[model samples]
Target: MEFNTKPDVVVIGELNVDIILNQIDAFPEIGKEILAQGMNITLGSSSAIFASNLCTLGSGVAFIGKIGKDSFASVVLESLNSKSVDTSHVIQSETVNTGATIVLNYDQDRAMVTYPGAMEDLRIEDIDFGFLSTARHLHFSSIFLQPGICEHLPELFSKAKSLGLTTSLDPQWDPAEKWEVDLSNLLPALDIFLPNKAEFLLLTGTSSMEEGIAMIKEIAPNLTLVIKDGSNGAYGWNYGKLVHQPAFLNTDVIDCIGAGDSFNAGFIHEFLKGSLLKKCLKTGALTGAVSTTRPGGTGAFDSVEGVSKIAAENFKMTL
Candidate 1:
């Protein structure tokens, strides 16, 4: 698929090597250990999969992120290149090792332990404003995990907005058992804010989704907020109307690792095609559901034709 000469979206975040161990009955105890049934290594990370899916769906994508000069980074770059995501803006660092995650799958649930490594070293100074100015949209992820990016988000989004580029952000779960941030200040800079129900609640300090949405609206009056509810589906508010889209049911569950990233890709894909907000939410849910049936986040799909088929069969929407 030939994309437009100018890039449609640029994804800025972290890339990591994911080492997945399959079929474990339970997480290892402090002093006890258990062996996994199978293991696999793959290129993983929110930005990586987001870019991959966008490229697969025939979007012009450029990824700006940090990785170490190790073989892990090599594998990630190779994978991205194979998927046609432009990697010219990916910076190579020597101080930190490329990030990696150890995933243990038990039953249908999984546990992950991640070392930020080079991901933490991604600084705003490494960004090239000129490259970002060329994109129609900017998708940012894992901000809270990368302190540097989180601190400099205002400047980054300000530059993008100044250039008339719409900005979207996905804040990953911060496992620190506490949520800290001034959403009131951050949300105004973002055109789209995508967060899972749990993250939304944590960020807003609200007990109900309704309250969370209200709080977000208060902060970012002009922004669109998307709240992803795992199996139940997704909810979005645009033009003061609430839209709910159910998740596409999948028969088999593989790994839920990159589901949200895939959802982001799907949402952006349909939104770019001028789909309605509700339809875009459904597309995101559909892609996320389909992603759970696959083992890896950046796994192959039918791209436009395949997603269209899924939409017709599962989502009951015409592409």
Candidate 2:
């Protein structure tokens, strides 16, 4: 189906079923069992959350990803549909299993173990560029984990750029040290690179954020680099200007499973609206802060006005 107008954002990456186990005291020892106070199932994934958050912020969003023809995949599809995100580009695989993650949350901290499953099958052939061509911005997340997608990064980014689409990437760490592609070649193709503190350190092999920023600049001088430091807030280096925004002060932390994704949505929303970089960072911090107060990612705010209220009353971000 064709949209009357192009969507503001198209997210391409992994989609998964997230099983959250809450109120756990600590990690269980091997072969040992523990009980959790609560358990919940949610539709989640880097790209999925980002797309849903963008839609929640009132941007038209389309998601392109792969999911298996399983019950979990059905749940994910239903969740995305309920959120009003377009899922026309999603491919259903008959043989593979839907990717799944088990999230253990204790206090504000969390640990996740993921099984890529069908997410690893997402390839260039699976992508329907027709959907991508109709987007103003493209967000590619969890690239490192999806080996097939990584191989076609240059071509995909190049095509998107030719079509005048802004491209962003949220780099996930390669657990197996299998990052063979030279990021220098890919960095220039991306307009924005959002990496958390640990991922930035691994990507650039830098001891500090300053060094990472400096190193990234040498390769892609014009690219905007945003590094998220949990609790410490976020820092950005754009066009030689440095911007640091503190996290919204939250006394009670519920779950942080999707804080980073919420931040990305907030930043992209403000950026697309032509807001200043500082303002975008503030919005992102507020998005993340409010997300942490909720149980899940997409339920953090019901509307843009909700986010605005959180920004004003909870975050109190200053320009």
Candidate 3:
């Protein structure tokens, strides 16, 4: 059960490439076309971004996800490898095309259109328990995008817990708008549940943060709930108390892509290191702010030293 040489974290979730379009003059109308002044293609997916950035932050990270054996898959592999994250466990499908997201970036916010592709085909049966046993922690994301494994999330988390691995989940936005996961069955098995404010509101079916917190506590009293509130900050419910970490504001942000995933990465990085909840939230906020300074999620996370420099210079905080 001891994984001395294994990765610090194993990320099991969606994978894809992002085609980011930035600096658009106006939102596109039904018949009218719009011009985007900048564009960049990079690895995309909450899980992959978290794994890559976490590895960049000195965690031994590995990834398990499905991607097509195509050019875009190459981008995903190369991007993860560039971060020194283990990709040997990633699955490649010959028939299915790799997933991709076209992001329309508008200053501080963006709209995304995703083609789920192989990501939707990643079922729980494809997961390797032997490989999972090699990591100390398990982090899953984008539940709404992966239907094959979505329904079995509770079972998956339960199994991971049985195997003695700490677990976390980030239920990203549900494109279907149904918000259909069974949280009552899933939260008790999960150690951490990270959801942005809007996602928490939708998933919990509550109008305000206090209501959502009360509801979640009723479902899983011991669960650590972290609400990522953009601009305002992040809120954490741990040990029966609420804690808030303000956002490390970045006025000259290039884009907000992958900022939340980066926040998860930073938080998990500190969590696995036994840091205090407040320190973890601060690290999360700092990393999230650092992510906005660059083009994409992984751009500003080339190295810990590089990130530290940016944190000091841009955000006035030393990592």
Candidate 4:
């Protein structure tokens, strides 16, 4: 497979919209409704959020995902297109509808219910190695949401690596609570493994970060490991050393809906640029904090300039 095109990053995973209910009076009860003060239907899915914000961070990003031929699909496309992300590889499915997440936001906390429709249909066959070769890096997220991708991730990462592209994977919280990824085999092919403290602990089947770190080290000693600890910050490991980057404090957090995904976008954006690991981690924490400043996953990232503005005003840093 060959591709003459050049893109900094190619994101392959689920795509969906987040229907957020913010400032709710109370949590919903069965056969009952709760009135919310604010609401926003924005682009959802960790993969899409990462791709969109990564693009906003000045990366030439492209997305490869499946969506339905419906209005929600239009929202997905329009949202990505608005961010100037390449959507040439996004498939429009006829049978399945576009996936969606109903987000119930309660101040800093959130509960999400996802209906993965077309996203579930994205399989290894749908992935084109030639298309992947067009980019310098491959970042796939929400492995659990895309059962098709989850089933054959090792091969997918291997194929991307064979094409001379660096790769990263963020196995977002598994909805079924079955973190079933074969990390031992998968980590070797994955240049970067971005998982939060909880997800990492579960995936590695350990009680502590040190224990989980030891387990993965046995298989992938050279792997660039990053563990995102919400509020506590992020940690990055390379070789035998570990570096911790504290969370950029956000005093007025609206919600933590896609903070981890935003952190991933920040980390991977710097990573593709060949920045230092510590710098990437710091940027990730800052970006994650920026995500909390707004209502939805992408509110703080309306545009490249918008992200810069948020970074300057809110975080007292430049993007």
Candidate 5:
């Protein structure tokens, strides 16, 4: 069962493109048309962002997901390949079209409509367990978007663990609000679980972050839990102790599009390096802040030097 172990992280999740409409005069109505000052079509998917940015931050990363054999698929491959992420495991399906999100940016907040398309088609059967063993770690995100993987993904996680791969997951917002994945079987297979403040609350059905941490810790006390809060920063619980890392504030922000994914990239990069828990939290927060200084998610992380320069100049810190 020997496999290629060259990659530091292997990300298996959704992939898509984002059609961003900025400076819109008004929200689109049923019968009325609206005008937008600018539009950009970019690689758009939380997992892709994490892989691209993680590679930009100096990690050997690889991606596994489903995309259509269309122009959009080319865009996804180009974006990830340009960042040095191995895309060999990305399955291009001819039966489905690539997924896309229409984002209307309005200052700090925005509205979005996503076509799941091929994202929902990735299943446990589609994954390559041999590929899983090639990486030192495994990270998955956007569980709600992929229905086929949502139920049996534990099989993959368990396989990764049995193959000596550390695992992390970012259960992004579930549109259904059902939060149906059974954590009892899932948490035991995961080493790290990264969720935002709201997602953590909803996932654990708790009113507060502390309450949610308590619930999950009760099941898997040794798991490393990192909950990202927008302005307040990030909180991490590990070895039965809680650690807090305040966010690096970016007063002049273009947009907060892929901030969370950026945070995950930074944290995973540092974690894979065997950095201290608190340092990983700080790096994650700094990278997340760097993401806001630009227009899209991967903008701030174009290069390791670029991100390092921004971290020192804007945040007065080094990555």
Candidate 6:
């Protein structure tokens, strides 16, 4: 694909491939092994899923991340290219291997172990401000998975803001359980901050959603805090008032992989189009439901028409 105009959004974060194993008989023990009835390998990473789905939703998307020169790298590139997400800014490293995640899925929940290879090598110095200045919005994800760039996130978001770009961050799970991010320095620079229910609690050091929201109000008063709460749907802070958007329930959920990232895609897509907060939240919930209808994250979002069809047929909503 060629771009004659600036991209609508530029995604800067980690990239990897997911090796998913589903329908496992039982959990694995130290001395025993388990069997999985289904398996698949696809593009895996919050940033990749968000970029691909957002591009499919009619936004011009560009990716800037690091990967290795290997088969998994090929899979990552091809997957993003298939979605027409510009990957020209993706750096290919000869030294490090591409990252990968081994996922053992059971119904709606799953456990994962990741090997952060090239993803860990991406740093603030690798970012090209010239290319970043071309986009109207900037989104970064999986802060814990990329230690090299983690501490520099504030600088990154600050620079993007200085260049007149709206910014969002989806700090995915902190595998170390020690959420070391300095939100005080970071949150002030972000236009939107996306975190799941548990992540929000942990990040805020609070036990309840009320406490978390209160902390955010004190810290980043102007920030748009979007919390993804599983089947209960999502919550967005509107003028300091918490508003709820219920999920579009799917009785036959294939899996819950990449649902949050899809939600971010939908929300950000509408947000860039200058839609209202309620519309963004609703579209996010609807897209999240669409993700579960298919096998993987990008499966249900094959095309714009297909996504609309899924919305109308499965969720009784016309997009």
Q: Which 10 residues in a row give candidate 5 its minimum summed lDDT?
A: 1-10
| Local distance difference test values of all predictions, in order | 0.83, 0.84, 0.91, 0.88, 0.90, 0.93
lDDT of 1: 0.83
lDDT of 2: 0.84
lDDT of 3 by residue, 1-319 (tens): 1234689899999998989898999987899998999998988888888999999999999888999999999999988888888888899998899999998989777898889899999989999999888789999999988998998989988998898899999999988899987789889999999999999999988899999998988889989999999888899998789999999999888878799999999999999999988999999999999999997778899999999999999988988
Which has the greatest lDDT? 6
Better of 2 and 4 by TM-score: 4
Q: Give the per-residue lDDT of model 4 (tens digit) for 1-319.
A: 2224578899998998888888999888999977999988878888888888888888888889999999999899999988888888999998999999898978767898889999999999998788788789999898888887786988998999899999998988887897877887789888899999999998998999999998888999879999999899999999889999998789889878689989999998888778999899988998999999997687788877887788899878986
Error of 6 at 88 (Å): 0.4
lDDT of 2 by residue, 30-88 (tens): 99888899988889787888888888889999888899998998889988887788887
At residue 129, give the lDDT of candidate 2: 80
**Which candidate gets the maximum TM-score versus the true structure?**
5
- Model 5: colliding residue pairs: none
TM-scores of the candidates are: 0.90, 0.89, 0.91, 0.91, 0.94, 0.93
lDDT, residue 179, model 3: 92
Lowest-lDDT window of 10 residues in candidate 4? 1-10
- For candidate 1, write residues 1-319 as lDDT tens digits: 3334678999999889888899886778999888898998888788889889888888889988999999899888998888888888889997889999998878867788999898888889998888788889999998766886788888888889999888999998886856788787788889888998898898899899888877766777788888888888888986677888888776666767688888889899888888878878977888888778656786635476875675677557664
RMSD of each candidate relative to the true structure: 2.8, 2.9, 3.2, 3.0, 2.6, 2.4
Compared with the true structure, what per-residue lDDT tens digits does model 6 show for residues 68-110?
9999999999999999999989999989999999999887678
Between candidates 3 and 4, the lDDT winner: 3
